[model samples]
Target: MAATVEYDVMMAPEEPERSEEEREREAETCKEKGNVFYAQKDYNEAYNYYTKAIDWSQKNASYYGNRAATLMMLAKYREALEDAQQSVRLDDTFVKGHHREGKCHLLLGNAMAATRCFQKVVELETKNEQARKELKNAAAVLEYERIAEVDFEKRDFRKVVFCMDRALELAPACHRFKILKAECLALLGRYPDAQSVASDILRMDSTNADALYVRGLCLYYEDCIEKAVQFFVQALKMAPDHQKARLACRNAKALKAKKEEGNQAFKDGNFELAHRLYSEALNIDPNNIKTNAKLYCNRGTVNAKLKNVCKAIEDCTNAVKLDETYIKAYLRRAQCYTDTEQYEEAVRDYEKVYQTESTKEHKQLLKNAQLELKKSKRKDYYKILGVDKNASEDEIKKAYRKRALMHHPDRHSGATTEVQKEEEKKFKEVGEAFTILSDPKKKARYDSGQDLDEDGMNMGDFDANNIFKAFFSGPGGFSFEASGPGNFFFQFG
Candidate 1:
């Protein structure tokens, strides 16, 4: 059986065609070239080679997936998403296609879509560590964003920092996270922390306008106004359209102006000018507690110097309103009230000063004011006029008239002009006192602590000069006036 059968045994002509295998080899070669370009960061060339590989072999989902990755690297996220979708359509089981699509969505800032794609990849392959990690990162970013938004709205800057920290932990290379951290720290009044964060961001991105602007605000809060202005100016240089930087620069300049002007005025002993400048500064920055306190204190001192007793008390009251612990304001207000003859109010202010923790100088001043207030309560204006408590109305009038005649300027013609003017003022006061006590109704009203006009009306709208003339004038009778050098009296009613 083996004899003749070997005769016709000829090797079947080897099949010479391998078109599918050849195409696959060529696609793989193109794919390798694409990977090389991608590794070198030549995305355009990588994209071209990946496209060629995909065109040459439709069945290779890897080629489409790699092309999408290259597109994503070039920030052509929409196109990359389409290619990745095509790869998934070709073979839904391809893990790389799903990962690439997810990455594309992430690059496009579609966190929800990216999360869904990554989650699906994790679902399909439990051992897919990369997919699992991506899902976790995407979900953390979403949660952080949501919480941070709410925190920012509520002005809970501390919570904003905590949420952003978690986000930065998940995406350490995110520039936005760094910028947000700086802002949150600044809002929390952690100026030094915010400055450090902003500096780190600037190191990573020298032209980062938001980071520079935030750094400026941090510097401003730290009281480094000049340095803050520099940072804001730099930020404006980087981005001329940055509104925040512009506003910060303007505010910083204003603060600097106020500080300089106020310091100079204070140095020059211009207390009123200094007070106004400090007030302007406080207006620009209402939260500046020191400036507010200084302004009130300085204004109080100026009012005292100007002899505006009530105004001095009011300014000191405002100082206490701004800072209840201001011992100086309480003491100053007490002194002003004492000067204005407000003995009860002055006693109250002095009591506050006594209770306050004050320096030795302030304590001594407060003690002195309290003693003065006690003395003021016992002061008698009628006793200063040297009138007896039981003096008859006519007797009181006679005593005042005698004193006025002795000090009358016309009676001292040889005296200096200044002495004459002083005497005339004293004579006028004496006449006014006599007029108030001579009339029985006026005397009763005066004794009862009621002001009575010359016409026996209430003192409302009564002019002291008009009342004096009406009291001395009788109907159809003459009032005395020394009109010439001689002691001759001319009278007109």
Candidate 2:
């Protein structure tokens, strides 16, 4: 059995108290050490010392504020935010604490929260220039981010540049802004400018993954394929999971291979094969402006070689749509229309080429188009059919039948109903002209320059195909396909 000994409760004397002044003195020593570390840019060490000072004197707002700034420098943004909030909580009138909190939020990528903190700082201290500056910066960053995201989603590279420029003006030191600006410039085909921007970013932060990625894109655009691959490799080294860098590297390598293949094909005079290779490159990167433009222009040339004038015009039109300032597209489209005897459309495209091009060759092209337009308008149908003005009646009938069968609407079914109608009208006109010329009496009258409707053919007899063949195919010998829209000519003609 253990004896229960009664033990007297000994009351301990009150622990020695620290005077507020002594606590403050100890806090000052910690603060001084923090400032030394901060000046040396040892932000983590500075943060530790400043936090120690705050713990020593919980009521000192300045200690908490300084610690928050050090935490921000260390990129411990959430912790810095808490410390700054505590600072302002301890002394709500402290303008510096509010400003520090805003900075922490900004570093944390919480622009709206930063904005609120800055607004509060400005409200409490209207004349705090630093707070006002921070507020303006935060607002600009927020607006820029919003606009850039919207424009990027819309594929509006021009508006992206506008928004990113505003952001750069506000946050000149922001790597994110610089990267976005470079991307916009690349999209706009300002390769040289994009390269310069990317280089500047790399110079400032050599290990920056985004900067390396963007520099790779610029190099790829500039046709420096090998160098571009190196840049992407470096970016991957910095951030192994960078999807954009990996994609860019793969695309650049593919483009280089495709370009080589296309060049060889072009040199071998295999225009169709060359066009196919260029198309493949474009498919790898649809936004590749240079490749797309080149493909359009080259495809137009191939279509022309294949004697597909309308297809050539379509290809050239696509080129121009991809890049409105494509002078080659305008010129090629004009040539296609001219070859097809579409003089009015040719004139419009020629005018566009003239507006964009300053070369002497382009001036000559414009002059040639104008002259051709005038000549085409004056071509006579009778001269094109190659019949004598005074052939015998039997000979005239023979010639009319031969010409009608040769230029018959059944040969060109793809023409529109209007075109078929025009061809029929032309055929009737030729028949009537032959009837008048073939008759000895009527021929004599016509020879004397007298107006005579000798055939007496009614409007119903003058079919549309005759008119269209005489008007369009008369001079240029134009023809339509046999299986397309205007195949109604088989029933009527």
Candidate 3:
């Protein structure tokens, strides 16, 4: 059997060792087949043929570049980047290799590195339109990055978002810009938009710590505190040294603890303790608008319980300013204004609440506040007469006589025109007061806070001269008039 095998081997024409030229020709053939598959959009077959070409001729830059292109088509960006780097290393003067390298770097989110590669391409072929366009795009991304940093430092989050959008248009594969845009959206109180961006990133790379942190930030601002805390914790687990994540996680935990403590204190009727805890919670993270808004509202509730109506209103106003959608804050402030008899302010707050909520309860509260405001705007007859709501008819008459004589326009004839005008106004008010209070029916309606029409029992029917004449003149047409300085005389016709 050994003899037969030796004879067969000897008889078979000796296969010549392949020359370098022959191997190169075979590699070119494989590359042509890869190109054909690529033109057919059969990326898997193209990748297989290109890989074979690289194996056949490992030193060929075109083989590496072709394989890199196929890997990019497969969405294997890191692998493509490695192959692109190898292509450029084999042939530094290859413009296609450098361009592909830049594209890979850009897709990998290394914009600065991509900019360098694109710059190399431009230097190699100054008139290469594709290379020039790519370089411009990369440079634009860097410019937007710089602008975004400045805007973010200035707290111009809207401008930051604009710049991030521009950067994203230039580098759509860049995760860094997406993260920044998501963060800015969260800062602007667009929690859903921010969450959508962060969630998309998480779908692509579940372990992306920055994406997790941004998602947590959106959830935190949306008042999903427990879910936010879980995301923050997971982000911290992934990246222990992430400063923003660390701080956010710490603040979220502290805020939860403080807020819970305040709620407990409030439930226990310890208003002062509750206020203090809520204040501490607010100080924990001023930038956390969503949490801080609730903290302000909680402190305002405590203030209301303590009968600090003005302070409560102030706190609730701050909460509404921080978050306009905070219906509870608006409702609380309206109540505080109502308690303090600030009907105008109460009406405004209630209107805002009703507009946002549109609930029957809110609508009713708004209507009640509007009614109180209308009543407040009306003339206070008792105040004009300097009499109490409980004053007897005799007492009201005495008060009216005293106030009318003091404010009569004739009595102020020697004063300035401005003083006389004011006195005339007061005199009319006093007469109107007497006209309403002297009649039991009118007084009853006024006391009941009824809206008397202009012609019924209001100032429209008031004539100061007629009221004065009726009060002073007797059956013999007796009159009381202002005479010599500060003196009064009576006469009968």
Best by TM-score: 3
Off by over 4 Å in 2: 1-98, 104-151, 154-172, 190-197, 219-227, 381-383, 386-493
lDDT of 1 at 255: 76
* Residue-by-residue lDDT tens digits, candidate 1, 196-241: 9888878867999999999888877666788989999999999999
Clashes of 3: 0
TM-score of 1: 0.44
What is the descending TM-score order? 3, 2, 1
Q: What TM-score would candidate 3 get against the native?
A: 0.80
lDDT of each: 0.74, 0.76, 0.87
Whose lDDT is higher: candidate 1's or candidate 3's? 3
Clashes of 1: 0
Tell me how far candidate 3 lies from the true structure as C-alpha RMSD in angstroms. Answer: 6.6
Error of 2 at 282 (Å): 2.9
**Could you give candidate 3's per-residue lDDT for residues 178-253 as a string of tens digits?**
9999999999988889989999989999999999999999888777888989999999899999999989888888
| Residue 386 CA displacement from its true place in model 1, Å | 25
> How do all the candidates rank in terms of lDDT, highest first?
3, 2, 1
